[model samples]
Structures are given as C-alpha cells and as structure tokens.
Target chain A: MSKTKNFAVVLSAVVLVCCGALILGQKVNAAGEGKITGTVKLDGTAPHMKGIDMGKDPFCSKAHATDPGKMETYVVGSGGGLENVVLYITEGLTGPAASQTATTEPVFDQKNCMYTPHVLALDVDQKFKVTTSDQTTHNIHPLPNPMTGNIPWNQSQPPGAAPVEKSWKAPEVIPVQCNIHPWMHGWFVVVKGPYATSDSNGAYTINNVPPGSYTVTAWHEAAGTQTQKVTVAAGGSGSANFTFKAK
Target chain B: MQRNNLRKWSSVFGAAAVVAFAMPSSAQQTKYDFETRMNIESHVGNITGHAKDAKPDYRRYCVGCHGELGDGNGENFPWVDPKPRNFQLGVFKCRSTPTGTLPTDQDLFDSIGRGFDRSNMPQWSTFTKQERTDLVAWVKHFSPRWVGEKPGTPITIPPEPEVTPERIKAGREVFARVQCWKCHGVLGQGDGPSAATLTDDLGRPIAPFNFAEGARPKCGDTDKDIYRIFMTGLDGTPMPSFADNIKPDEAWDLVFYLRTLMSQHSKEKAMAKQLGLKPVDPNAPAGQQ
Candidate 1:
C-alpha cells in the first residue's frame, strides 16, 4: 500500500510540474510582449481643408452654427502634428501574436454631424461599435471591398437608437460614411496585428507586440501611407516616427 | 463587307486581350475556372438547380444585360440608368437576409419571378420553374463567396396583424421614430432632404423610391414584401436595414404606415384617409410624432 501511494504521489508531482511549466510559459510570453510608439507629423505646410456646408440638414447646420464645421481631410495640430493616422506592424508578427483579436470594444461615434476619431484602428475580428449622439438620423455605411472578404453593410441610427456592434472579417481600410450627411466621412483601419491611431497630438502607442523586428506601416486618409522598420527587445518598446508631406 | 467583318473580329479579339491583361490577377476568372464553377448547385424547395443548365439561357437572354462575366457590364450597360447589378460582388438589393449577407436561394428565385418594376429586368414568369432555379445557381457561381459561405439565415417575420386605424397611427409613429423621412420624404415622396445626395455603394447617384409616384417598389408589392423591405433593407442602395433599431412587431406597423404613403388604394390607406392622418412634421422634436 505504501509503494502504491508513493507511485501515485510521484505521478501527481509530475503532472503538477507540467502544469507549472505551461503556466510559466504563458506568463513568459506575456512578460516578453512589448509595445511600439510613434508620432506622425506633416512635413510641409498643411493643406486648406474646405469648410463643410451643412445647410442641407437643418439639424446638422444648427449644431455647428457657432463654429462652422470643416472637412477633416487634413487635421494638422500645433507643431505640424497630423491626426487620424493609423499605424500597425505589417511584417514579422506571426502565430498567436499576429492573429490575436482584441477583446476590448472601440466606439465610433457620430457627434455634431462629424465622426469622432475620424479614423478608428482595429485588430481584425475585433468587435467595434457605431453610435450616434446627434439628434438627427444618420445611416452608418462602411464600404469594404467584397473581394477582400470583408462585406459592406449599411444601418440607420435615429435619435436614441441602440448602438450597432460589428467586426471585420479581414484586414482592410474600409471607408465609413453617412449618406444623410454626405460630408460625414471616416475610415475603419483594420489590421491583423496590434495597431494604434494618432491622436490630435499625432501620438500613438501599439501594445502587446512580442519582441521582434517588424516593418510598421502608418496610413493617413489623404496623405497615403508610410512604413519604417522597428525592433523591440524583450519587455522593451520600439518606436517609428512618420512624416507625411502635405499634398 | 468581308474586310469589314475581319476588322471587327480582330478588334473584338483585341479588346478581349486588353480586358484579360488589364484586370487584376486576383479578380480574374479564367474560362477553365468559370466552366468548373458550372458544377455549383442551388436547392429551391425540392427542385435542384444546376449552373451548367443555365449557360445557354444566360447566353441567349441575360448576356445582353448581365454580361458574359456576370459583371453587369453588358452592351446595354452604358444606356441603362441605374446600372445592372455586378454579380461578382454578390451584394444584391431585395434580399430576405439582412444587409451585407448573401440572400437565400429562394430569395434569388423569387426576384427572378418578381421582375423589378421601373427597371429593365422584365418578369421572367414566362420561364419554367426549373429554368429560374437554374438561373439562380448560375448567379451564385459568379461570386466565389458562394463556395466559402452559406446564405445568411432569413429574418423571422411574425404573422402580420390585421390593418386598423390604431395600427396605421402607430406605424406612422414608427416611421417618425426611425426617421425614414431622412431619405424617403415625410410623405414618402423620395424627395427627402438627403434624397438628391444619395448614392449607391458604387458611388453612382441613386434616387430613393417615391411612394407617391404610384410605382411598385423594386422588391415586391405585397404586405409581407413591404415588411421584408424595411427589415432587411435594399442592400447596395442608400436604404439601410432598421432591424437593429426596430422590433418585429413595430416593423409591421411601419409597413402599414408606408402603405398609406403610396397612391394605391389599400385598407391601410383607406383607414388613414378616414383618420385624416397628416404627414408627420419633420420639424417636430424627436418622439413628438
């Protein structure tokens, strides 16, 4: 009976060791994950963004009566900081690190007849939301090339309507627009790996990237895209700064 | 005449060569691949549809409008106003399924029979049922989507309630709540504020359906058809599905209210007339309808 007990104890210890190693393996992966940070700036004089005429919709015009709305084609901040630029690691990411879908949902709002955060970056298959805060009706239409495997969809959100939750099946730079307000335009930048969008200050940080050398790409709606090579050490961060010339 | 015919033949071959070379390799559908796709099949009721069977019929009738590639770039493409549907995209209006999803085989079959009103596509009711089903299969084979994905589940439609004055009033409220007037005018005249600026997915200018014009909707004319139209939405157009915001019971009410906007006489229209219903004031604050 004592011999049998000893054998059982040995087997249990072996199993526990395997479990501990597996847990440690996962923890090591999490600990080894780093981040990429960057700032995107406009190199030359900022182009003139045309003023939008919201006179067609009485509700929209009234909301922007005080400070007239202008097209967001190029929203350059102080110091030539470019806003609404999406950056992502386009190369070197593979396996779980590349295919991981974000769990946290991002909100894309329609406020004052304009899209809040004009460009939303998302990991492929990450759930995102479309919400309308304005009083008037807005139809949220995202046109993704069907050939790319991401289908296009259109939905209306009247005042007080519930939010619509959706996710992209593939990586694409889908254009989102409000048909009711033609001037209302935005983009959904979907990539397979971790991504980030530059804020008003042209600052962005892409987290959860495993240590590796990668080619990071930064895309702007009007100015097009730029890429730079970056390398992150274990538990350290890499950086790639982009400068787009004003067209 | 012989020299002219020879030149025409050469030009046709030249154009074909240009098309083959110019298109992106990813989008190209080689003749061999297209022929292999003929094996694709669709099931409608108990009838089986084979894409191979519809080739001759498509060449005879559909090739003039739908094109050889099913890209809707046929010889008549330039003259047609609202352009033929690009089947390569697999995005269709009048789907029983929700927006962004493929329509069921039955939906495609029904559309073949319904024949869009005010459109060049004539009613194919003259064709045998088998021919129509085969055509549906042929349509499916054009897009690679059919091979990878199944049709979306059709939305469940509750049994339509009898039309009553209260229902009509409630339907009007539903219409106002959803702000259908943003595109389809308050009076459903297709002259809403945004109507002039409306465009399809292809960026082509498209006009919203004017109920007051006395023309049947491009989808269908029955009460159920009306219900499906708003619930599923006419994809590829400015019209969007209200399924997310609308409850099934409320959707029926909106359908009844939409009927009153049409010039045709109906129970809902008669009840609306008796009630002396006025158009919802677009200026009224939301929920005041």
Candidate 2:
C-alpha cells in the first residue's frame, strides 16, 4: 500500500513538473526563426505486407540489411518523396509563415521497378515533372481527384531510361503506381508553403522565415506528428530538434 | 453440458460461421506505407505482445458487436445493418477487383483508417498508426490459415488493351454475347440476371451498375476496371472476374458495355424509399418492376 501511494505521488509530481516547464519555456522564448530538423523514423506497427517477389529485378532483388530500398520498405528518404508529412507551427504559434507555389520538377523514378521517393512534398497549383528511370511502364494515379481517376497517364520507360516527366498541376496525395507491377506505390504531397524537404540524411531546412513566435511542427510518414515552439530572429537561423518515439 | 457438445460440432461444420469470430480491429491496413515496410522482428515483436493488449481493446470497443472470436456476432449483432465482418470466416468484399479473396493489408488499412464512405464502419485514423498496424496484424492472427504463406500478397493484373474506339466497340459486342446484361441489369445497375440473387459479403443483395455510381470500388474505374472484374469475381458475392471464360479483349468489351450501364443509375436515390406507397410489383420482371 505504501509503495502504491508513493508511485501515485511520483506520477502526479512528474505531471506537474512537465506542465510547469512548459509554461516557463513558453514565456522565456523570444521571437525569431529557429531551425528544426531530425530523423523522421518509422516506429509503430508495420503492415504485414509479405515480401515482394524479387523475380529477376536486380536493384530490388537484394541489398544490404539496412539499405531501406532493399527491405521492401517505404522509408522517409529522398526516395519516399517526403510528401504530406506536414511540418508546421504548433504552440507559441504566432504570425503567419512564408509560402509559395513553386512548380519545381521533382523526379519520381521507378528505377529497377520500385517507386523512388516513397514520399514527396510539392507546392500547390504547381506542375511537377515526374518521370520513370525504369524500363517498365508506369501510371501516375493521384488520390482524391476524380479528374485523373488513374490520370489517363501511362507510359513505359525503357532501359538506360531517358527521363520522361509528368506534371502534377493540381495539389493532391497522388500515388504514382507502375502499371507493370501493381503493388508499387509512391506518394506526392502537394502544398503551398515556404517549405523545404528533409534531405537524405533526415535533415530539413526551411529558409527565409520572418522572425516570430511559431510552434514548428515536423510530420513523418510513419513516426506521426512532432510539434515544438521555435523563435526565428531576423535573418538568423534558430535551432530546434525533434525526436519521435516508435511504439 | 449440451452446450459443450454443441461447440465441437459447430466448429466442425460452421467453423467459419459469421457469429463465431471477434469484431474487426479498428485499425486497417491501407496502401503499403512506403516508410514502414515490415521487419520480421516487428511482426514477431508485436505478436508476442499483441494478445495482452488485444483483450481490452476487444472487450471495450469490440466485444459488444464483433464477438469474442471476431466472427461478427456479438450481443449487438441484431442492430448492425450489414453486421460486422466475421474475421474467422475470412470473406471480404470491396476489393479493387471485386474478388472476395483474402484482403490485402492496404485494403484492410483503407477500411480501418478511412471508414467506408457509405457504410457503418467508422474510421479509426484517430488511433495511432502503430495501434492500427498492431490491430491489423493481431486480426490476421485471429485466423491461422495463412501463417507460413506470408501476408499482404501483391495484386497481379491483366495486360492493358488498346483503348481505341474500335476495340471499345468490339469489347461491347463481346459483352453482349456473355449475357453480362442479365444480373448487372441491362444498364450495369448490378441488377443483372444474377443481380437480385447476389448477396454481398455481408449477405445483402447487390446490383452491379458501377460506372461512377455512389462510390466506385477501390479497384480502378476504367477499362482496366472491367479487366480486373473479369479476372477475379468480387469476393463474398456472385461477381466473378471472367479470367476463366473471357479473353482480355472480351473483358475490355464487357467494360465498355458496362460503361453504358454506369450512366444508367449513377445518381443517388435521394427519395427515401416511399416503401408504403405502391410496393414494387412482384414477379413483374426486372425492367418493368
């Protein structure tokens, strides 16, 4: 009974301490642009998708134990496209953030019959040129849009594949699938933001943000959402790090 | 004592009965998460710990409806319209191709994360993805028929046909020859010859007019749509794909003919059934009735 009482008291104390720290932390932070970056990890229960038949495709056939591409995975890397993992301001949220519709061409390659960039982020009203690096035929199937219901866009990119890009003029979580292989899927996240994608090393830097009190949020395709207050001084890069837990 | 004997006989004959399994897990497997492909460690890790966690979840959110074993017959079974899925039985509908085969992880994910647009199944996206993932895995554990085969098989498909008008017309002629107009209604309204007799995965009659109808099934909504339908019959019901009888070209023609049926009843029946007013004439025939 005494141990139980002690455990209850300790739990209550921990809660109060966390709440107190949150309040003090919010008040002490001054306004400015802070950098937020960290590895977007996949921590929860993964799907029971059986191992794909590597048949004869070499790249996907085999690789290192940790090479995400080899594991029949959808890792949040350059290959994942970093789409829809929304990183925005959470608490201490202040003035609006910078944004734009840059119609840049992000390559959605199907090298060796796999959807490169398992996740990707794009600007709204922007046209993204997507092309396959594989010799197999591919189809760009954007979700939620009835217009391109399967997009009526299908083509084959032959070996030594010359780049054949398709533009996504509208914003959507379009899943670009290979007509050759049905299970292959990749995501295209389209948004209007002063947003920057995390690099291959799980790093992201959004430049030119005006100084203000913002709760920067980092979204990961698997680890879930992460939010923290960040202050950016004029023309200065503030520092912030987000850590996610895999349940 | 009699009940004990009933259990043994029951499992032998009605082993897959709808009322014998547990309620479905709220978490569904959707499109393969590109980020979190499976690791055997995670599979084993979760399985080791899943049983303990599964009990409470089943009791609190599922038992009242899905039954102790996930057979879709809890105490509240009478109230649910389409009844919860009988996981033990493993009959699933609404697959991309209409075949009632074992559901893909993504298919289950779609059902859990994004509740059916028109059904009573509620979306459990509010639950953590891990929770959802664990739940789906645990549900798969409910049935041991697939232990060694591995999970989530890739969906194979037919070769694409040339989408020219001539091919489309030729496809239509083949469609007529197959008498597809019978149950899917002449208009593809799913009211074809076998339409009225067709019961969905949940035991409800289903009509097949599917060109832009309420919500298109997960499979494509194109000529390829017909191809898959023809290849694998929709699971849980009478809609089998024609892979056995029709060639790819003929399947395409069936699709073209089906498209004509799509426009036939693509609108919602906003007028609630004025059931009391002039009951439909029985035996009057499909079109006239």
lDDT of 2 by residue, A1-247 (tens): 5565555456545545544433444232324434444444344443343555543233344431244434233334442333335454445433223223344577666665566666666655555555556432233333333222112223333333345444444445554444234456666665444455555545667654556666676766555667667776665775655555544
Give the Cα error of residue B202 in candidate 1, in Å: 0.2
Model 2's CAPRI class is incorrect
Off by over 4 Å in 2: A1-247, B1-64, B94-101, B123-128, B148-155, B158-162, B200-213, B218-227, B249-257, B264-289
- Position A143, candidate 1: lDDT: 92
lDDT of 1: 0.87
> What TM-score should be assigned to candidate 2?
0.36
Model 1 per-residue lDDT tens digits across residues A120-239: 998888999898898888999999999788898889898888999999988899998989899999999988878888988899999888999999999998899889999999889999
- Tens digits of per-residue lDDT for model 2 on B52-128? 44556657776777788777888888888556777665445544422323555555555566664444576778766
Q: Considering only chain B, report the TM-score of model 1.
A: 0.88
Best by lDDT: 1
